[model samples]
Target chain A: MREKIIEKILESGMEFVSGEELSKQLGVSRAAIWKHIKALREEGYNIESVNRKGYRLAERPSDLLASNNICHELDTDIIGKKVISFETIDSTNDYAKQIATNENEGTTIVSEEQTSGRGRLGRHWHSKSHEGIWMSIILKPNIVPYKAPFITLIAGASIAKALNTLGVNTKIKWPNDVIVNGKKICGILTELSAEIERINYVVLGIGINVKTMEFSSEIENIATSLYKEGYNLSRVDVVKAIIKEFETLYFDYIHKNSKLETLKVCRNYSAIIGKKIYILQGEDRELVKCIDINEDGNLIVEKDNGSIKEIVSGEVSIRGEKGYV
Target chain B: MREKIIEKILESGMEFVSGEELSKQLGVSRAAIWKHIKALREEGYNIESVNRKGYRLAERPSDLLASNNICHELDTDIIGKKVISFETIDSTNDYAKQIATNENEGTTIVSEEQTSGRGRLGRHWHSKSHEGIWMSIILKPNIVPYKAPFITLIAGASIAKALNTLGVNTKIKWPNDVIVNGKKICGILTELSAEIERINYVVLGIGINVKTMEFSSEIENIATSLYKEGYNLSRVDVVKAIIKEFETLYFDYIHKNSKLETLKVCRNYSAIIGKKIYILQGEDRELVKCIDINEDGNLIVEKDNGSIKEIVSGEVSIRGEKGYV
Candidate 1:
């Protein structure tokens, strides 16, 4: 009832609707409407009321992450059909995995903060309170387990393209990271539960630093955020754009088996192509030149000995010539 | 305490041990010893009491699947360190996955019956009560996810070698099936929880029809049990031998990064190596001649046009010339 009342006020376009009119429209008593208005105010919605007038939605809470706020006008068919918003969580991916068997594909889990965020390869991800987009999407693609690694590339391309669409220039750092100005801004962790021939579920966890300005000394040299890079954007807009872009690319690849658009975005907006990089494998490091990503999404590189090599995504890590990119 | 009492009785080697001696040796009262003996008898152990002599072990219940019976003189360091036995379960793989994160690498879960056993590619497996070995082993190998499909081959190799060692001629069907006389006697289902770069755990489910004399009409043509095939082996011996053989092959692969032994067993005792088989993909079938298994455990086949092609395990299913293998 409260959301319906808020929706009515929002649809009225800042014009005050009389209480009797609202009661007639929403099929509620005038007293019930007043009570809902009061509750909405307490929830940080600045609803304004005047004498001989009724409620008008003056402003919405910018910091609050609610389903209504994120899914208000989101234009996506499947990516964010059901948005589960949280104030804080241990990890969105952990929560998604717990309900993955019961939830439908494209069920999105978002939180304002994560107490124990996780990165790729069992690394700790620094997710402070309300400073970034800590989210996970439960996907049940009808593909085999061998085809799951490419979803991470689709997510990377989506994030980079979404930020660029929002006027914040970003580039994809190969398989699963999004970077801006040669600094890391996003990371994707893809986990799978599968049998030998089929995939049960995939939890695609994405963490993007949006409003974070301060970083610990350990990661300050490499880690960055959109706000720190002087591009201020709202989290809701960024998430909506990403979902829209992801749905298009994801559906194209899964339904049609076409990687053209994602490959185009990845190649055009890549940060490491034609650059000197170091491939790190445990205690061994080798200098290699970035070539191009093949149709199978594997990285093609040229070694210093003038030999070409194709690198699969999960086998090693790549870095810029001097530092992390 | 009950298991210890049974161990003591078995160690006596058909001799009787008095209650007074058992109390002194095990530091329990005679009444407590008597109570444990009574409980053990209720659990289907055969113990004979003679006048003036204590209790002598007559026989063990062959139908019962307990840790003490399966682990009796089981020579393995890492495969069966912890054995959890159940009378009934939905699926041993499901139970193993539930405790996989908290349990050790080689913790094993076994059940006498599975109400809802599963096979590869979301197929249903029929596991009758008290007639088969329905078991799953949880392993946390420090290998990447791409290398996980070969573990299914390792398990198949182990089952074939163990059955061969017991004087029953069996052959491995390339990846994850064991057959006797060109009919499947065992099936393996390997499930993995993994990230892109590392494996979290693998639930290796093995179902061997040991004493089944009947099968549903749907699968009777392609499925047979060891007893039906005239082997007539005890379930206890089969389980112990498979565990011992699995421990050796698993350690060699994960520790030494060697696929030599597993590939050797798979090739030497293969059922489809020199036969014409049909590779089924959805509704399409192509007849191909089996050439060999490569070092990576992929099947090599020769097409009708004399062209050689490599087939990965999970991408397609292989069948005998006319029916399921």
Candidate 2:
């Protein structure tokens, strides 16, 4: 009820809506409306009261990943049925696991900042306040655990496709990284909690640098963001678009068992498909020519010996021949 | 220190060791030895104290899944390096997952009873106090998440082989059930927390009906315990054997990437190979003949149409035509 009232006030577009009108529209007492408004104000929403004139929504903070805004833009059946937003969290992935069992599939947990964000293979993911999309989606797909690796590609394709639609040209780097202009703009960390044969739940932790202008000295040469790359996109819009695109692609892959569509999107917007890359296997690095992503979502590469091999993700990290492409 | 004192007293072979001797051997004062004896008494150890003759262990409780008892009998290098025993827990698998990230790979969590023990697909596992081995083993195998399903079969084969060595003569039913005399004696629930490419940890929850003499009416016909089947095996010995067998089989698959040993164990102690069975898929049951245990742990079955197909363990639940064979 509070979310709907806030949504109505924001949709009013600088026009005043009297307390009596809001109470009637929301089917609540005027005192109840005032209480909700006070709560929203405490949550960083700005509302102005002109005595008897009415209430006007003066500002909608860009950092607030309010469910009302994201749900208002969602158009899919699954993948965003429930949205949980946090001001700050240890990690969205960690929080998602806490609620994964009871929460419905397609539930999403987003945070403004991650104090101890995690990347693949024990790497630290930098998630500063109000500058990126640090979110985790709880998925309960009825697929075997072995089929879970492909879900990462599904997310990668959806993220790339969504960003492309918003005019931000991003490309997927094989398994999980989303690159832009030869630098990484996003990282997908697909975490699965499953029984041997069954999927208990999957937490898809996606981190995208939206408005971050500065990176640490160590990563400044390789990390890039939408705002840093000169694309001014709303975080809410980008989040909604990613969820919408992900719902469609994920369901297609789950229901139809069709990796073709996801593979098509991946190949069209891949940063390493036809390029020469180095496969990093625990202190061992070898150059391999990237081949096509087969029907399965594994990376097929031609080794220096001219032998074709399928490289499973998570077994080893892949680096670009020159740098983090 | 307390556990070591208990071990020494038990190993004294009915001879009463003087308190002064114990204090000197343990490098502690006689008062400290008396305090440790009181702690052991609180833990249900039956120790008899004779006024000048000293202290002797009269009887040890059968319900203790103590780390001292389990680790003393373990022959493996891993799997039981660290054992944590609880009097009662919600679920060992769930508890293991909570500590999986911080705990070492071979850490084991055992509970005397699970208040709400869980089986595959949300089934309730009946874990009466002190009647079974309700334990979860934390494993950090450097394998892709796709290979995790086979780990369940490795566990099943290990349990079957271990029990057979102890004269119980159990057989594995397809993926995870260990059956004896046409009834289930054990169930292996393998849970994994992993990324698409790497495994963070695998919780192998093994439940064996060790000394259970009775069951609820619903499962009474399908479930049988080691004691009920006339094999009065000690829980510690069974646990040690299973861990030893699993450590050998698990390392073979991990270090050598060899499934041959696991498959050999599975085929040798299989209950359903070359037998007619029904594959229970949702509400539909299809008749299929189990052909062979392939190199991979998947069940190769000939359907009614005479076409051979590989059925992943989680995709379908196989049951015997007449009963649980």
Candidate 3:
């Protein structure tokens, strides 16, 4: 009821809705209309009020992520059916996992800022307040646990495609990092809680530096935001596009068992394919020629000795820094 | 210091230690010693106090899973280096995952009773108070997430071997269930929190019906306790042996990259290696003859048409229930 009233005020633009008129349209008491307007003003909403003119919504907190705002632009069916938005959180991934068992699949948790955001390999992710898209999508795909590693690729491909649609040329560095001009603009952390044979839930934690202008000293060289790269983009638009792209790719992979679309996106936006890359395993680093991404999403590369082997992501991590390239 | 005092009392058996003696041994004042004793008694430890004879450890509560008791007979270097014991918890698997990041690789969490015990396929596991081994082991192996499915087989093999050593005659029923006398006696629920590349932690939840005399009607036909099956094993002893056996097999698989011992134990103690079984998918069931346990712990089976195919545990579940050979 409150949201509907707010929506009405927002749609009214500069025109004021009289209390009697709002009550007649909404089928609520005039006191309820007055109460909702006061609450909206308390929530940082700019409302102009007059004795006879009633209420007019001056402005809204655009930084806040409401489900209506996200769903209004959403095109997917399941990815964002229910959005739990927070102004500040410890980590969206942690919160999603905590509630994944009880919540329906495709439920999502998003935050303006994550106080202790995390990345792959236990790295620290910097999520600037209201500047980056810090979100975790809960997926309960009816696929085996072993098939889950490919979902990471699906997420990467979706992210790359979504950003590309917005005229930001983003490349994917398999198997999870999304790069823009050789620097990481986005990272996907896919965490699974599964039994031996079945997947209970998968928490896909995605962090995109949309408008972050600066980063900490340690990651300044490796991390760059969309705004820093001279693209002023709305975090909400990035989120909506990613979710829209992700749902299509995810359904194709899960329902149809087709990796053609994902593979196409990965190969087209690949940052390392056909380039010389280094594979890091423990303290050992070996340079290998990137050939092609195999059907199973493993990296098939030819060693300097003219031998070819598929490098599984779980067995080894790839690190091709700027100097190496 | 408190644990040491309790240990001293436990080791003394029937002998009583004077307050002054306890204070001298613990390097605390007599008043502090008395306070500690009161706290220990409040934790359900039965301590007897005589006027001049001082405090004698009358009995140790059997329900509490003290780290000292679990580690007393522990022989392996890892797997149970640090034990977190709880009297009652929602679920050991849930709690283990909560603390897995900060704890060491081989840290363990054990509870006397799980209020809401869970099993494979989201079934309810009957965990009666003081009558079952409800525990979860945290493993941080340096293996990729794809190789983690085999870890479940390793856990099942270790548990079967451990119980066989105690003359329980337990057999593994593929993947995760440990059966005795044609009924399930233990279940291994392996949950992994991982990325596409590396595993953050694997929570191996093992539940053994140690001395349960009665079960709920729904599970009574399918579940059997060690005590009901005429093996009155001690829960602590079972826990220690399983951890010791698991440590050896886990290290062999992770460090040495050897699944030979695990495969040998699994094949030898398999419940359906040579039997006709039914594979249960969502709504499809197919009958196949189990031929052999392959090198990777997958079930190699032959259909009636003489077509041979390897059955991966993650793809479909096996269900060769009663009245089926």
Candidate 4:
């Protein structure tokens, strides 16, 4: 009866359906509808109400695993077919990698809590329980191993676009992190297996903190959750939006052409575009002038001198000389 | 005392010193030296005795793991150190990949058998006990995720060279299999973690059957061991030689200038130069002609009608071109 009341309110879509009507439809007391609404609100849902006008769906809180959420507008054939959901886990990325080798392409693993989460380079990911979104997608692309890095760029771009849709102006922090207001809010990690000519499969894990209150003091300066930024978006909402955006990009990549319009879009959506940043070129961190990103998504950084060097992967962090936008 | 006698005999590099001198140096009786020689012979060492002439080194089998055996002239700065010898393990590749993220570069894990070995696409690797060299190397290369596939080429080249030196005419099946007599004798698995610009670490797990007597009825047609092919070799010798080749190639790769040279050497050493092969290209398996080998060691595979594609990795199997050479 409680779940039915909530479903009724969500399906109404427009003008608030009276509590009395919800109770009549669910065959539950009006008090029960109010209790479920309170519970939903506590779960970071934005429910609107008035004097006599019962509840209204202000936001669905985009989540990639929501049954009607991620599959709602998903238009791709091989990105997300059967979505697997987890309330909590040790590591979604590790879990997904194991499955990608066995399952076919587009099997998604989405989780709400990850106790032993991690990022690139073995960095600990603070995936506070119920405060973030962690999901991984399987892909079987027909390309050389050298081309696998582009998928990361595509993932980063999708994240940036999703956040942008939510009215949060985000920046790409070279490689795979999505930053908002100078703080990182998301990360992408990819693992794969292949022979020289064909890719066996790729596991792309995306983590984001859409509804978080407190953060670890150690990463307080660098990490910020979606809720912390005054936007208490539901985890389900973000997941839905992200999958939609990813499907569009992936379709353009494989269907449109092998060059993947997504790749072209990636060149422009790159995080380090025309920005002066500090790169750990060798053993020293140097401030390099902004130039352009390469076709391979590498940073074409111009040093203090007149020379320019291509900074491909490895500890090349972007430090905004003035301030991160 | 016996070990000292063997060491002194080997280091002399000529006519072995009398057992009396070895016994006096080690403070042991000549009877002990004789006893040690009997054991050494059991372990495949060929020691000759000319009656009153004392023990003279007539022939020393190219030992597998003896300190002065293979890898005697290793030149690389890292990639092969602290080799752990094991009679058997569940899976050398799994053990190595699991620890590579934690261990530093140059750490190597070697085993004589793998109860649950693996091949590409999650296939089981047949590792006959005491008849193969099962090893994994922990390498930390300064590259990006895109370049991760090249690691396969690197390991394949090393395996090819080592086999050539041991007088086994073989061919690479592109990506990571060493085929002899049209049957795979070795498989290389490269696993890594990284972002677009940086690769955190990579684990290269290689399994080569030096002597496989017991054959699985299912895999007997597709697999062959060195011993099965009349090649007299030691598991320890093969492991060390592979390490030496890998270290040399890795050292050259890090230098940037000689990296191309190293790759060239790998190609010339590869046996799939002019052969017909099958590649599981994307979702379809197709027969392709093995055309030119590039400097990056990627095989240039030509389709049925002149469309040549450079394949870095996938599921590749060389046909019985010249009966697997």
By DockQ, the best candidate is: 1
Stretch of 10 with least lDDT, candidate 4 chain B: B63-72
lDDT of each: 0.89, 0.88, 0.86, 0.71
- For candidate 1, write residues A5-71 as lDDT tens digits: 8778877887888889989998989999999889878767888899898778777666556677878
Measured against the true two-chain complex, the DockQ scores of the candidates, in the order shown, are: 0.73, 0.70, 0.63, 0.22
lDDT of 4 at B179: 80
lDDT of candidate 2 over B157-186, digit per residue (tens): 889989999998788898878998989988
Higher-scoring candidate on lDDT, 3 or 4: 3
Tens digits of lDDT, candidate 4, A170-258: 77776667887778888787776553345767788898977776778887787888778877665666776677778777665655634
DockQ-superior candidate, 1 or 3: 1
- Screening candidate 3 with a backbone cut-off below 3 angstroms (N, C-alpha, C), the clashing residue pairs are none
- In candidate 2, list every pair of residues with a backbone clash: A313-B197, A314-B197
Error of 3 at A161 (Å): 1.1
For model 2, the local distance difference test gives 0.88
* Winning candidate number (lDDT): 1
Q: Higher lDDT: candidate 1 or 2?
A: 1
For residues B3-78, what per-residue lDDT tens digits would candidate 4 score against the true structure?
4565677877767577787778887778887888898777667777766667766776664444344334544456
Q: Distance (Å) between predicted and true CA of B8, model 4?
A: 20
Predicted complex 2: DockQ: 0.70
The digit string of per-residue lDDT tens for model 3 on B220-314 reads 88788999999977788888889989989999999999999999998899889889899887799898888998998889999999999998887
lDDT of 2 at B277: 94
Cα RMSD (angstroms) for every candidate in the order listed: 3.5, 4.1, 4.4, 9.1
Overlapping backbone residue pairs in candidate 2 total 2
Candidate 2's displacement at residue B116, Å, is 1.4
The reply for model 3, stretches above 4 Å from the true place, is A1-8, A11-15, A18-66, A319-325, B1-5, B11-15, B19-51, B55-66, B321-325
How close to the true structure is residue A52 of candidate 2, measured as C-alpha lDDT? 89
